[model samples]
Target: MADERETRPQADRQLCGLVRDLASQIEAHLRTRAATLGLTPTQATALCELTHPMTLRELADRMSCEPSNITFVADRLEGQGYLERHPHPDDRRAKQLLLTPEGSELRGRLVELLSKDSPLAPLATEEQDGLRHLLTRALIR
Candidate 1:
């Protein structure tokens, strides 16, 4: 039992390191793809998350960021003609963010770019499904 306890922490540390490394690789890939369209990683991420109109607070929550940070992102995207802000229907004090037609077009292109071949592309369909299931379970836990 003592031996098991000692190895558990080491195993957990190794798992954390592996997860971090994978996340870094994915972020680097996203950065490279975003640059092709003259967008920063954060802007690309924000655009990707805006599939439908939502409030800045909702966006911030989805992005795991502060509302102020999301404001900056929205400002940049709006300036670029990719998104627009309108008064929320029910909330006079809040604004909803929606993608412009141009934004939607660009988002489609971004999806194509991200869906292109990557490290996981070589996995068989069953393997991919299994990986997704395992990752989902891990995330929920």
Candidate 2:
């Protein structure tokens, strides 16, 4: 029991480090693609996530951010004609965000760019599947 507890912290630290490294690589790749389309990483993320119209609060929740932050992103996107704010059907004072045609086109391009190559391109298909399974299982736990 003592040995298990002692090794657990080390194992956690290693796992965290690996995850951070992988995230950094993925972020860098995404940032490059976003820049080509004149978008900040957050803006690109927002565009990709808005597959359907959603309230500002819902978007904020999905992005794991504050509502005010989402409002700022939405304002910028609206100014760029990439999105629009429409009155929510159920709430007189609330609004929902919908991507414009331009936004959808750009989002499609962004998806293409992001999907061009896997970050783990060096790994075989089987290895990639195994890694994905392991990661999913860990996340579920």
Candidate 3:
């Protein structure tokens, strides 16, 4: 009763700290991995998430950024010949971003690098799954 209430705040603060530390480690890992492929973390993330052609608006939604932000990413990728923008078939007002062949190859290598030496590499498969489930459950609440 009173005992539980007294510890709950401390427990929550500790959990929040742990989560932040983990997030920092993961971001560092992503930065390192993306650098190996000559990409910024955001660019690498965009490339990896582009399984199919999508408009800037859609990419922004996936990357959790504003559509304007995605334009900069798309411009850099397009300049490097990693992707191209074509008029959207369904939307006359929007353009779809498609990965070039080179982009696909780069993304494959990027994925491989990202899969190795992950911040959570120490966790076993079941532990990772459990953590993911818990995180997902928490997010929904």
Candidate 4:
């Protein structure tokens, strides 16, 4: 118990470092998987976060990026016939982004690729759930 007390103060710093390392691994894995589909990392990330039709602002918030960056990514995806913009249901001036059939297909493939050999793959299902729970709790200010 004495040793545990001595180490407790350093645990938060160590945990933060581990989280950063995990994020880096996940980003690298995403980049590699995205490349196989001819997508830039940002575009792939946007699509992954777009599982439902949502406004640019909503998607941007989910992506933790400025709406302007998503605007450009949306344009590229639209030009490629992967997505379409529609007027939001109750908002007069906002547009919601929806996946086209091609976009849905690509998103499916991307999800499949992401699931394989992912950074959390080594964790058992329950352990993964525990980690997610802890992280979400940490985020709830």
Candidate 5:
């Protein structure tokens, strides 16, 4: 039998592998960056969740984190001028999280930084569209 590298399309496999590595690297890089913005990744995610002003419990569920963990993230974000916690008008004892103007601006900048074009931009566009179509068809059942 041939060596594994010679047995298959090595370039294609390497490209896919590199894409996964790049994604991991991006996550780590952004995690560090969140600090420069006075937020942790969890806090940033919580603020992003607040575009809809959900309750702490609901935000915890959406963020797949424990309620206490959500509260900690929210508290930090709130202290950092990135979020506001207000009484839920419908439930005076419950609190809802909302993004402050600064948080919105930060989220926008984070999105922009994460979405900058790469040398693989053209191929990625075609591949991403194809993947989205295929995944949508597969998952929409």
Candidate 6:
């Protein structure tokens, strides 16, 4: 019985390994791209989330990270002239994040670099579409 169980094909293990390898490759590619932009991976991701203006808490939620982590990323990006903190139109104490001209330009370039044909792009369009569909289905649950 133990032998039968052990011999059963482990699709889950194989799929998990493939997913992990893909994720690692993406992380490495993004790290290289981030260095070229003078931004850390976290900072770049935060800026990506700011395609529209949002408050720090909102950004943190979108980033799925701690508020403090988002704050650190925001501070660094602001110092680099990639982001500006503006007074929240509705709240006296809260600040909204907006990209500077420099930030907008950088974000555009970043999008180009990470687009469908970029490193993260799958080898073929069909593969890319399939992965997207599968991942979307998985995420919806």
Candidate 3 has an lDDT of 0.94
- What is the per-residue lDDT of model 2 for residues 1-141, given as tens digits with 9 covering 90 to 100? 999999999999999999899989888988998999999999988988898999999998888999999899999999999999999999989999999999889889998888767477778889989989999998894
Of 2 and 4, the candidate ranking higher by TM-score: 4
TM-score of each: 0.88, 0.84, 0.94, 0.93, 0.64, 0.84
TM-score winner between candidates 1 and 6: 1
Each model's total of backbone clashes: 0, 0, 0, 0, 0, 0
Question: lDDT per residue, candidate 6, 1-141, as tens digits?
Answer: 887677655766788788899888787777778778888899878877898989999999998988888888899899989999999999989999999999999998887676734654546778888888998897895
Assess the local accuracy of residue 71 in candidate 3 as a C-alpha lDDT between 0 and 100: 97
lDDT of 4 at 115: 99
> CA lDDT of 108 in candidate 6?
88
- When 1 and 6 are scored with lDDT, the better candidate is 1
Per-candidate RMSD vs. true structure?
Answer: 1.9, 2.5, 1.1, 1.7, 5.1, 2.8
**Candidates 1 and 4: which is better by lDDT?**
4
Candidate 3 per-residue lDDT over residues 52-72, each given as its tens digit: 999998999999999999999
**Ten contiguous residues minimizing lDDT sum, candidate 4:** 4-13
TM-score of 3: 0.94
Residue 57 of model 1 has an lDDT of 94
State each model's CA lDDT, in order: 0.92, 0.91, 0.94, 0.95, 0.74, 0.84
Off by over 4 Å in 6: 1-9, 116-119, 123-126
Candidate 2, superposed: residue stretches over 4 Å from native: 1-3, 120-141
- Candidate that beats the other on lDDT, 2 or 4, i.e. the better one: 4
Best by lDDT: 4
Candidate 4 CA-lDDT value: 0.95
